[model samples]
Target: MLGASRMGAAPSASEEGEGEPPLTPSTCTFTRLVAKMAADKIVPVALELGGKSPMVVMGDADLKRAVAGAIAGMRFTRQGQSCTAASRIIVHRSLIDEFLAEMKAAVNAMVMGDPLDEATDIGTIISKQQFEKVKAYIKRGEADGGVAHSLSQVPTDPKLGEGYYVQPVIFTDLPSDSPVITEEIFGPVTALIPFDDYEEAVEIANSSEYGLGATIWTKDLKTAMNAVHRLEAGFVQVNQNLVVLPGLSYGGFKKSGIGKEASLEAMLDHFTHKKTIIINMT
Candidate 1:
């Protein structure tokens, strides 16, 4: 059976129902009996919700290095269909133009087509629904009066016609309140927000409702460390896209997501519970 809920509707009985078989005969009488199931028999569940992560470029950051890192952060792993994609870019006002130019060049060099094609740098999105969602955000960006810089025209291949594909799009001079800036587009769309100083940049980056992951690119150790302290994100990357080391914890704060995954720490947290042991040697 299929069940659907209207926007803002409260959870329904059907939605709350769990089909898992009861662990004991008496447990079946309870309204929600899944809690009584045996720990060893219970199936594990995981949720991978994406986020609107940002990249903050400090004033003293090397422009070449910042641009390279920013592009990699934004466009890495096929636009990071995963939850950790850096969709927003916050740069110092002085270097905004230079960074945008370099980013544009880098995106333009990407060859979008078949995922199996050795020459293809970017591939088609997962589904038509996702494609439409991404295209709607692109249209919203144009409607919100943000300048759209598309890197490549849509391909004419009939084989690719069966799937959804969109060119990489960048928006400049986006207002802080714009939907493109505020919402998670979950595609190859990036917005460049300019700030006059470090404090202002931190404010803009932390103002979002979602606080999953953030990136700070700078050559100065002090600036990177300071920004890391100020940013209110679960994962803070410094001058690189590989933020969480293997066997380290990975998760988000605020509305971006719940709980953690992707490391030994998360596995231990999920699998075990701590019990205080008290003993008195009198």
Candidate 2:
């Protein structure tokens, strides 16, 4: 029998954990370990797992501001290797062209170099295998009728040429239901699917199985408020995206995860237990 220590975390047995993922699985180890923890050990488990987050852009949204939010939300600096990356962009049909132009300029201006370098905007993919997987996804995105703007075009810098680095890519014109949009790529790739109205935008955003986070860009206060109520995600941002802090409980709805994280709720529920004591006054 694999002890809780072997799996590398025991919520009941351990001290307070800092805000970081306990495991970064290179294989099926995370899955196997989680199964053992929940099924066999029968202990408290709060899973903070995968996501395919969405960002919706209404026609009235400030393009420049929204584009900046999109870049920040994309996690391009981390090679888009984040669970909360809002990489699925559903833009207003009338604004797709303008959005694409701005996004291209934003991505082009980013500096991809050593992770430790202060000036570098982004770093390489985790490994050769992961790099190949991202490349394959880009190819599949094209096969699914999405037009790729930039396809893994590594920079000409001699220092960055030899490794698992890939440039950020944007795929436009794909259907809302395309696998590239539905699946979590976990790379610095985003898709642009156009919608005719706010209703369709919300519909498209809520269609994904994973609902970790979402962003809504609009100037209409009523529309933004409505979206805040309607969007099916644990974390919803209006007019901005991808802000994580200790005060906010981080987790996802549906298949994204099991419980809350990084807040008092998580600390009390998952990391601590409840006990009742009764005494008789004699």
Candidate 3:
């Protein structure tokens, strides 16, 4: 029961921050304005920020489902330009070889062309700046000793040459601390990393500075439920990727952002301002 929905209260979104100075480039500008608003005893904020989300593939997971989840979770279908994109693929060491082989084939086969075309798998980067940023991130991944597998099909029509079309890319064998592994690369790029055990897998996935969204792939209900408890992301889905169901709240934790999005909780929890008035009957 939010006052906003029932009583005409204003709606504002800001991150839950600790009284610290804004540091992340992604949220600093808006954070400053939020701080100014707070100084005036005005709006309180709940921030829903960017994510370096992860997809964990257990050894017992269905390889096809896990690989398909990987492809979808990376947001490559949208040029990987989603804040909640699960860009980190943390696979069980036993499944890395097969996972990468399947992923490589799947990624390569996607046809990149006009968004208007029904057959096009994905389309252009939003702008020249973002286009270069995506390319730079790929290069940085290479410099960090990560091998990139670029999607083979590029949109090459002379008519559509002006579009900012960059093929999607997948990087493998990256170190845990590699920028490509740790930073938020908001492009059609993902990195494949491996871990030895369930504990290590959770550790790798939770290592992200941004805990926006995460997905775990497996057949075991026990593992899925266990992972749901252990993963640090705000939204952890099992056997699926990037799912936003009706009335389910979605948001980030840690540096990914704050507050909830798309649910009753957003109004009643984050955006609500409770007030009470009392008067004498005299």
* lDDT of each candidate versus the true structure: 0.70, 0.78, 0.77
Give the deviation of candidate 3 from the true structure as CA RMSD. Answer: 8.4
Clashing pairs in 2: none
* Candidate 2 error regions (>4 Å): 1-33, 151-153
Highest-scoring model, TM-score = 3
Q: Rank the candidates by TM-score, best first.
A: 3, 2, 1
Q: Is candidate 2 or candidate 3 better by TM-score?
A: 3
In candidate 1, what residue range of length 10 has the lowest lDDT sum?
1-10
User: Compared with the true structure, what per-residue lDDT tens digits does model 1 show for residues 224-277?
Assistant: 889888888788889886555676667766655445677876776666666999
TM-scores for all candidates: the values are: 0.80, 0.85, 0.86
What are the candidates' C-alpha RMSDs? 9.4, 8.6, 8.4
Off by over 4 Å in 3: 1-33, 277-282
Quantify how close model 2 is to the true structure by its C-alpha RMSD in Å: 8.6
Candidate 1 TM-score versus the reference: 0.80
Task: Put down candidate 3 lDDT per residue, 116-176, tens digits, no spaces.
Answer: 8898888888766566656666776787788888875776689888888888888887778
